[model samples]
Target: MQIEQQAAIVTGGASGLGAATARALAARGAKVAVLDRNADGAAALAREIGADGQAIGIGCDITDTASVLAALDAARAAHGSARLLLNVAGIGTAKRIVGKDGAPAPLEDFERVVRVNLVGTYNVTRLVVAEMVKLAPLADGERGVVVNTASVAAFDGQVGQEAYAASKGGIVGMTLPLARDLAQFGVRVCTIAPGLFLTPLMAELPQAVQESLAASIPFPKRLGKPEEFAQLAAAIIENPALNGEVIRLDGALRLPPR
Candidate 1:
């Protein structure tokens, strides 16, 4: 579907990949709603995108039904029902199932990661699709599209990444099923499993560490840019045939076991 003049909702829009996507969508003439847990950051980015009301920012916790409902309501009120939903809000953890001290990992930690990454993604998608289905189909018989974020760790999980890997793996697992379920409604689903990239969290590491991570990629030996991710997302939306696929944005990099 043409992104121009469409309403788009991007979760985790306050920063990182989500921020880049919001900006990209807005640039393509989509009225964007930046939903994030960071209220101030979200509002700030919205202001940066456009002061003429082309975008809005709402504080949202995708894991909470009430929060998501309120966010969707506000978004619809401001920009009409969203035709594009980008699920990018997620968290990571680095804890071994059996720690060095020979203790089991905290169950809460695993639950939190899965809750935010997998379950939270589903929560937002379900709510957004509910409204998207009500809208009249476009010329292509498409009502909406959803793009979810995963990680290469899902497939190449290293030591201490059990929680993060499992959570992202769930996203990878659900892509095709989600597409099939939403086919009748003309909503497509896809996923992106990104490798090491310079996100806000990654940037916090020392320069040497960052460079080391970048060197692991086989080609274009540098970190993936957020704009590159945004470009792919926009591409997925435009290409009607691309559905239920998980494309890796990692410069041909296969992560090593840590």
Candidate 2:
């Protein structure tokens, strides 16, 4: 689908990759709804994007049905039904199945990660797609497109990453199936599994730690950029043929089990 003038919803739009995506979509002339749990940040970014009404920031919790419904309603009211949905809101945690003390990991920790990362994604997608299918198809017979965010850890999880990996792996596992399910409704689904990138959380680490992480990438020898992820997401939205695939933005790096 062409992004220009289309309504787009980006979860986690307060900061990091989601914020970058909101900016990219707005830059491409899409009427953007920046949805995030960080209400202040979201509103700030929306203000930064424009006060001329090209963008709106909404506080939303993707995991909650009521919150998502209200957010979708607000976005539709502001910009019309969204044709582009970016599922970028997620959380991560690192907990080993067996800890240093030899006690089992907390089930609540595992549940929290999956609830936010996996279930939250599906929650927003289903709500968005439900509305998407109601819209008439465009000239290319496409009603909408969805892009989900995963992590390279889904493929090669390291020590103490069972919860994180399982959550992301669920996303990776659902890409093709979701595409198939949505194909009949003229909506396409795809996922991006990104390796280490210089996100806000990553930036909080020491310089030496950051550099060590950067060196792990096989090529370019630097961390991925949020803009780079936004570029691929835009490409996927514009390219109708790139459906049901999980493209890793890892610079040909396969992680080691640390």
Candidate 3:
């Protein structure tokens, strides 16, 4: 599970937590593949890592099975079998199931969120696990580690987050079973349910809005940093016994109902 010189695949590597994890992995000497739908951003990040030969950029829409398959194939071609799989690609939106407009939020929107956030994670995880099983195990017989991104909303979703919460809940539910199934293969699975983080998407909000969200935290009263999440991922990959759990990086803050 030592990251050095090993192949790692990071979905949504173009920005946010995904980008941070990819950079961290590369910095730790891992051959990283920046997989994302944002082709330009992914390519730019790969170049910035200064390992164009070892770091690659692959464009993919994780919701589409064919697109994900192609992305995984491209990564395998570039860096051999990937031993680290990071599932960080997802989308979120807020809408009441019933609205003042006299019509409920479109079902398509809910489906889209679930498809990308939940199904997408499963798609990439399945493909990567298959490939990881083919590789020879490392010391301690560990073949690979999968780090998935969930959300604090899974446990404390507000009024308008029905779709988002359900999707994240699915990920949290799968973590332990996945670890149990992959254990014999020396593949560890864990999920990180992050609270508010200073990701690019959140940066778009008004300053006051951002501050309000941060202030809601019981301690620190600030957004979590991407590097903090990356640190946990690094630790999970190295610790053989830390499997089958969803660790919240929420600074002891449980969210309130909105």
Which residue pairs in candidate 2 collide?
none
User: Rank by TM-score, descending?
Assistant: 1, 2, 3
Write the number of the candidate with greater TM-score, choosing between 1 and 3.
1
Q: What is the C-alpha lDDT of each candidate?
A: 0.95, 0.94, 0.92
lDDT of 2 at 88: 94
The residue-by-residue lDDT of candidate 2 on 1-258, one tens digit each, is 899999999999999999999999999999999999998998999998855788999999999999999999999999999999999999877878998999999999999999999999999999999999999999999999999999999999999999899999999999999999999989999999999888999999999999998998889799999989999999999999999999999999899989
**Over 4 Å off in model 3, which ranges?**
none
Question: Candidate 3 overall Cα lDDT vs. reference?
Answer: 0.92
Candidate 3 structure, TM-score to reference = 0.98
RMSD of each: 0.7, 0.7, 1.0
- Estimate the TM-score for candidate 1: 0.99
Instruction: Give the per-residue lDDT of model 1 (tens digit) for 35-96.
Output: 99999999999999965788999999999999999999999999899999999999998998
Question: Which regions of candidate 2 are displaced past 4 Å?
Answer: none
TM-score of each: 0.99, 0.99, 0.98
Model 3, 130-194: lDDT tens digits are 98988898768999999999999999999999999999999999999999999989899999999
